[model samples]
Every structure is written in C-alpha cells, then in structure tokens.
Target: MAEIEHPKPFADWETRAYWEGCGRGEIVLQRCGACSKVQHRPRALCASCLSGDIEHFVASGRGQVYTFTVTLQNNAPGFREACPYVLAYVELEEGPRLLTNVVGCAPDAVSIGMPVVADFTAPDRDLAVPRFRPA
Candidate 1:
C-alpha cells in the first residue's frame, strides 16, 4: 500500500462495504431495494421511500460534471500537495451525484457538463478514494 499518500478511511457499519469496495478498485453504490433508487453516502433507509431495504451494486463509473472548482489552497493535511486541483460534483449515469476530485488533466481544463469517469486512488492500504477525470 505504499501507493497511498493520504489519510486512511474509518468506515462505520453503514458505509463499510462502500469504502471497502473502493479499495478493490470498484465503484459501489447502494440501491434501495424498496424504491429502486441508487444512492451514495450510504444510508440505512431509502432516500426515496424511507424504506430500510438497501443493497450494494457496482456503479457505471460514468458521469458528467455538474459543477466544479479548482482548489488553489488547502491545509487539510495530506491535501497540500494536491492543491490547484479540480474539485467537482459529478452526476453519475444512474442519477447520484458525488463530490470528487477531477484528476489526469490540467485543473483549468475541467468544464461544466464535461464527461468524466472514475479513477481509484489508494490513499491508504485499506482505503481507495475515487477520483474522476475527463472521459
């Protein structure tokens, strides 16, 4: 896990699988079994119907930039070296939007409505953070 350069994740029961799957290079999302709506930021109850039935599934990993900003400065520990990066809200193909960093290109090149796809970064051995990039 020497590839990881940031903080490790501390996942609780509700988010355990989501975080663990990322470490294995998979983008997993929770889909409400009751309402059939896919979601991120795992919840015990379905966001649509408030039902306590949810299951995990691999996401398509394809999305469009809804909005974004380039971080010119940050002191949040382990993020200093990643300054001037593109931070964005990506609207996935399945309808869930996630806040993520857009890498693999110039920070200024990112634009609203641009197509993006997932890229995993193992900031810690047991944690793989998902970042997006131009597609």
Candidate 2:
C-alpha cells in the first residue's frame, strides 16, 4: 500500500476541537448562528455573517465534487506515491465547499457534481485528515 502525501493540518486554539472530532470519525463544520451558513476552515467567527458566535457540529459527511484535478507529480516527501490521485474541492450538503482529496475511485471517473462522502485517515496519533470518496 502506498501513502498519500497530504498537508499537515494546523493545530491551534480555533481548530483543536475540529481535529478532535475527526479522531472520532466525524466530519465537522462550523455554522453561523446569525446567518445559518456553514463554513469550512473553522474560525473564531462566521465568514458569512462575521458573527463571533459559531458552532461546531458534525456534518452528514455527504457532499458533491465541485471540482478536481489529477496530480501527476508531487515534490513533497512521501507524496510521490499519490501522483495520480484526485485533488478536489467538495461542496458539502451543509453548503460549504471544502478543500479535500477524493479517493476510492478512478481519477478519470471524477467529475463535477459527483456525489461523495467523507473518509478520515490518520497518519499519526496527533493528525486526522479528511478525504472524500465517491458516494
């Protein structure tokens, strides 16, 4: 089995709870209390309403592939094995487009509006990264 070279997630005060949620196999996202908008890349405030009141909740883990590209090469360590993998932006059912990798299917099969679901991969104890696959 080959390893996919994905970026390490940022661990900070604003995002600690999110990573913890991933460890428990939940796809988490932030929702704005003011606008009821979902946002990825969790923050202290809502991006849509700019309100400081944001709530973290588990996502349905179902989404659609908004866009994607097949990478033929990578310079990052341990990422060469995933040269032909699909890197995609998935639009969650919750209404946020998140940056993630699409797997469990042929790269050629990936297309816009394709349905997908979340898959969590932990390369190390402290890291839990979210990848998506064909639903």
In candidate 1, what are the lDDT values of residues 1-135, reduced to their tens digit? 012146667899899888888888878899988888888889788988999989999888899999999887877666766677777999999888999888888888899999999988844667688889889
State each model's CA lDDT, in order. Answer: 0.83, 0.85
Misplaced by over 4 Å in model 2 are none
Candidate 2: lDDT of 1? 22
Q: What's each prediction's TM-score?
A: 0.88, 0.88
lDDT of 2 by residue, 59-94 (tens): 898999999999888877777876788889999898
- Show pairs that collide, candidate 2: none
